[model samples]
Target: MALSLWRSVFGGSTNAPEDGGVAFWSSPERAGWLTKQGEYIKTWRRRWFVLKHGKLFWFKNSVVTRASIPRGVIPVASCLTVKGAEDTLNRAFAFEISTRAETMYFIADSEKEKEEWINSIGRSIVQQSRCLADAEVVDYGSSEKR
Candidate 1:
């Protein structure tokens, strides 16, 4: 219940910043936050009343697919957003692609898999930039009010 509340306020887990670490929020939408757990977005699962932003949205994705990554160096590729890059305590914050129209997947596993994907024309995966391309930043100046 409380977990659901936090989710409502923060939009979704995918929108949270990874660098912040893991944090549980009562009002996750606020900026310049510093709480008991102000790092990665928490599920808010540890409280009562089910805060406005605490629910399924906080969990991001719940999909689990058969992946060869679990057997090799990267033992959880299908479950990762950027399997080959960083390893989060939970997988889903990275930049992963799973389109079905003309789909091809990349899992971080044995050296051969990584090498093959990199050397191949498609199915290539790499570390992604952390900045939003065209997003507007809310300046801290108090000169104007919206």
Candidate 2:
């Protein structure tokens, strides 16, 4: 079957945990399967991705136990942008997430999935950035109490 073939080729038995199996405490904001471009080889490899606690993590398999180790991780706070990159990659459902140092590309299953990922990641970036900013603000009332 096509599904089995996809699994064999991609190394993912199922979609990544949609209900947050990766983290111990809270559910992940989003999780799914995406084909990501290799860092140096220019090859594409299917990865199970999870977005949680302002971080994006990818694994080789969908089964994420407490001992599971992510193949890679991108802190959402460090990301500057998440946007469609179909034109740049010449591939459908392609998008890019970039920080100051690098841009990583991923291909979703469909246009809808692509947009969903972009929105989720974009929101995470904004939310995480805001949290950092909030932490830096001086609290005059707290200072007065001391």
Best by lDDT: 2
Off by over 4 Å in 2: 1-26, 139-146
Please list the C-alpha lDDT of all candidates, in the order they appear: 0.24, 0.78
Quality of model 1 by C-alpha lDDT: 0.24
Residue pairs clashing, model 2? none
Which regions of candidate 1 are displaced past 4 Å? 1-80, 84-96, 99-103, 106-112, 115-129, 133-135, 143-146
TM-score of 1: 0.18
My TM-score estimates for the predictions, one after another, are: 0.18, 0.78
Give the range of the ten consecutive residues with the poorest summed lDDT in model 1: 68-77
* lDDT tens digits by residue: candidate 1, 2-121: 222233333443234221232323342111110111123543221111111111112222221221011001111121232332243222222122322211222333445443333321
